[model samples]
Target: MPDFTTDHTEPAADRVERFQAAASTAFAPLLVRAHDGPPFHATIRAQATGGLLVSDIRTSPVTVNRPAGRISSSDNDVYKVALQLSGTMGVAQDGRREVMRPGDLAVYDTTRPYALEHFAAPDGEIRTVVIACPRHSFAAGPDALREVVATPVPATRGVTGLVAAFFTGLADELPNVDASGTHLADALVDLISLTFATPPRPDPSALTARMIAYCEANLSDPTLSPRTVARAHHISVRYAHRLFAETDRSLASWIRSRRLDRIRRDLENPLLAHRTVAAIAARWGLYDAPHVSRLFRATYGVSPTTYRRAHSGGF
Candidate 1:
């Protein structure tokens, strides 16, 4: 195992520069802003075991951004799982904002943009354990991962609790190790894989929930349909329909509604103002511009352009 640690005695006057350099060495290049200004306080303890890097980050008030401009095509091979141990942090990614309290955990992809801001802790410092692994080392595929990204998983009781307990306990005991990560990496990978697995003999509601999650994760795919969803879950199209019958709407209707909803959401988001109406529509799988215009008029009583103007003050 390779270990790196930032000394706490380092002078605060120049800590920001030292912190950024140490951070980049510990993990990747991250845009770290010190909310407390000069005389900042932060420390990082990072350990590497094969393809996995576990980091214990303790810092004062700060906001971290993994900007899109900093990401390269070759730099997106890792996924980061964060376990909040002793503080509150707001995690923003994939259009979802989650406030993760102690014992809450979530995963995020390094390939995309994400932001994290730490709140004031009881001890005036925030502590979080983050583990990074190569995407190939993880069991879940990209599509499946989209559902869980930035989505907080409570660590009360279940596989999630087990993961939380294991990592938190590891943070407390890793200092005693004999400088070896013999099985630590493999165990972490197996634990995470178990967390992502589907439970055995799931009920109809659970299965339906899984199907809906699949749909939500792949809303941008034009080929995402009842048949494709059924195939993804290893069920027949009829069985998929039967499951959807339990819901208020049919599977196909739900898909269409969700796609339009995503488009409308993007149009209303000022952060996405750079995207054209057609581009936003296509991003959610509605590729036909004229058809989408008609659908928007029929659904919202306004064209997409007008709707964007009304909601987001034009794009």
Candidate 2:
């Protein structure tokens, strides 16, 4: 990992400016306002994890903003997840506001306008650790992503606790390590995946939220093969397959399962009771009757027709 460690110990007049310059390059353009007296003392230790930047930071009371113009000029299209190591930090973005305390973290998109206010406690300057996650690393679609964006993800317990621990310890664990961060990257992405995931779309961002969105929108087109998917996304077929490989199912299997799930739902719908199993299957681009039947039974423990019949009629 590439490392950068800096401490702003310059005279009070120049420290804030120097800190602002260093911050802009390390993260993004921000209008930084100091709340404490001048000659601000700050520290930032950041390292690149190939796909993400993990940093440990301590700063005097200040407010940072990524305004609309700055967002436009230098949009990395990445997301920032910051863990409050000590003191209090407040974040506001996308019309949502949150106050994060120790053991609390929040995520905000760099592509959007946001503000972070770090307050100095009686003890000292606010301390925090932040992770700069490339947008592509997130697998959740835009809608699902919204649920956590600018929202506080508590790290007191559950899987979120584990994620918090990872971010908290990453700075110390990764320094001077020469190996690639493939596994580490996957873990960060996976935890972020879990943090933002919800029911009705429980399927994680196996192929990234964008790729999954494209696949879902064209699921019924029949022409939506891996090659076509790759072409549409301007990515190679091998890359597309590799993205799916990150999940428990393959690309073809995922598509098939999604199609079957839709077909099953429609079959059980009273409005679609008049539709034949074959028609329902075709509507979802599943034309192979025997193959569909076999998979459906294997998945749901009942053939498509039987499942539909059992659920369609009144008791």
- Candidates in order have lDDT scores of 0.79, 0.76
Off by over 4 Å in 1: 1-13, 74-76, 178-182, 197-315
Q: What is the lDDT of candidate 2?
A: 0.76
lDDT of 2 by residue, 1-315 (tens): 223333454566576777777787777877887786644677787777757878888888888888988867445667888888888998888776667788777788887789999987778868899888887877887676765676666687788898888887785665653246778878888987886565453234644577778878877888777766765553435556878888898877888888888998898799988788888888988788888899999999999888987998931
State in Å the error of residue 189, model 2: 1.2
Best by lDDT: 1
How big is the positional error of residue 302 in model 2, measured in Å on the Cα after superposition?
68
Over 1-315, each residue of candidate 1 has an lDDT whose tens digit, in order, gives 234444557765467677776765655667887786435777677666656777888887778888888887756378888999877998888876767788878888888899998887787768999888788887778887776677666677777888998888767665653335748777888888776543454699989999999999999999999867875674546668889998899999999989988888889999999889999999988899999999888889999999999999756
| Residue 276, model 1: Cα distance from true site in angstroms | 52
True-structure RMSD for candidate 2:
16.5
TM-score per prediction, in order, is 0.59, 0.59
Off by over 4 Å in 2: 1-9, 177-179, 199-315
